[model samples]
Target: MKLINLITPSANLAELSSIASEHDLLLLRQDAVYLVHKAALPFPGKVLALESDVTWRNITLPASIRAISDAEWVTLSANASQNLLWS
Candidate 1:
């Protein structure tokens, strides 16, 4: 299954990038204004959007960011973050 991670500003992007498996899709902001799918891990998994460049805002992230996430928005801790972003 594919997972879409709408990361919060407080979360760590670097860690997720390093270990994330090549099966997840990351959709985030790019111009620090809107969202973009930056990179991908591998086949069946892709990392989309530039995490560092994007601006982190609750409003912009949730609703206007990526067409409103239909899946459950899981609040992941630093540890669990890896699973959500990478796993």
Candidate 2:
């Protein structure tokens, strides 16, 4: 699967958000964490939030999305063949 790692809430992601490929996965952290609720991710794809970032912000996200730790981040990176990072 393609791992979409977003570090910023850039307008550039508008086009990428519509990509609903089954092979896509989305991970948000840093400033991009603000898009947890507002940004649209790929359909039928798993969306993960950085647990540390979420906790630090004290923001609650939708129940549908998973919160992953740094260890899990490495695991996810290991599984994906392609990674697209946006800032």
Candidate 3:
């Protein structure tokens, strides 16, 4: 499965949703952690946000999105078949 990393709040959600499969992992990092406050997320896949970033932004995460540590992020990326960054 693909590890899709979205690093900016302005990243194109339409394009992401179109290209992402249900089995892929969507990782929200950097400014993209702001997306957790949105009413809905576009991608229909497992969603994870950097815990450090979320805490830095003081954003409360919903139950749908998991908070992962940097080590976990590294592990996920290493295990995925492909890693894609969206900025």
Candidate 4:
């Protein structure tokens, strides 16, 4: 899946809500936490949210997002297009 990540203040969610609608996925980040507002996972696949060097247990996200610890499985933004080409 191709995800568009935006690091904006929590107060900006109102203004950035349109961007979330345009992208296939949306990742909102503030401080050291990540919130998954939308996920474009293929059927039968899963979405995982991982944050390195930070404690994300208190972060609130949709139940659809699966939290993970290891970084190896997280998809890199740089390789997203390439991965999608083959998808």
Candidate 5:
């Protein structure tokens, strides 16, 4: 499965949604963690947010999005078939 990392709040949702599938994983980090506040996620896949980022921003994540640690982020990247970054 692909691991798609979003590092900015302005990352193109349309472009991301076009390439994402249910088997993929979408990781929200840095400013991208703000996406969890949106009404709905653009990706049709499992969504994970960096716990520290969310906490730093003082934003509470929705039930649909999981909050993961830095170690878990590394593990997810290591296990994925491909890693893609979207700024």
Candidate 6:
């Protein structure tokens, strides 16, 4: 199943890794966007960050993290077979 994981806080990397699977998308927003600067997410799945949030916070998301527009975010969420929000 296509899973989308929305991370809104700074989650533990190990915890994330433990649950992560291939191609499970992870979207970072709010405080969680900070993770991109510190390090790429542990998950091997696709990683995206909210563009505006990163811009407003002045966090330069790394190359490993793709920046997604609002429309893209909606599309991603909508396409997911399951949506999991982790705060």
Can you write out model 6's per-residue Cα lDDT over 15-58, one digit (the tens) per residue? 86677787688888777887775644567788888898889999
lDDT of 2 by residue, 1-87 (tens): 888888886646647767647668888888777777775554457778899988988879888788999999998889888877866
lDDT per model vs. reference = 0.40, 0.78, 0.94, 0.41, 0.93, 0.75
Q: Higher-TM-score candidate among 5 and 6?
A: 5
**Candidate 5 lDDT tens digits, 1-87:** 999999998988989989989999999999999988899987899999999999999999899999999999999999999999999
Evaluate model 4: give its lDDT: 0.41
TM-score of model 1 vs. true structure: 0.32
Error of 6 at 34 (Å): 0.6
Across 1-87, the per-residue lDDT of candidate 4 in tens digits comes to 455444433435444344333334443333423435434333223344554412444666567765444443344554454232110
- Backbone clashes in model 2, listed as residue pairs: none
Q: On TM-score, who's better, 2 or 6?
A: 6
- Number of the top lDDT candidate: 3
Best of the candidates, TM-score: 3
Indicate the TM-score of model 3: 0.97
Local error of candidate 5 at 38, Å?
Answer: 0.6
Off by over 4 Å in 2: 18-20, 39-44
The alpha-carbon root-mean-square deviation between model 5 and the true structure, to one decimal in Å, is 0.7
Clashing pairs in 4: none
Worst 10 residues of 6 by lDDT: 1-10
RMSD values for the candidates in order, in angstroms, are 8.5, 2.2, 0.6, 7.9, 0.7, 1.8
Regions of model 4 farther than 4 Å from truth: 30-48, 53-62, 68-74, 81-87
Q: Which regions of candidate 6 fall more than 4 Å away from where they truly are? A: 1-5
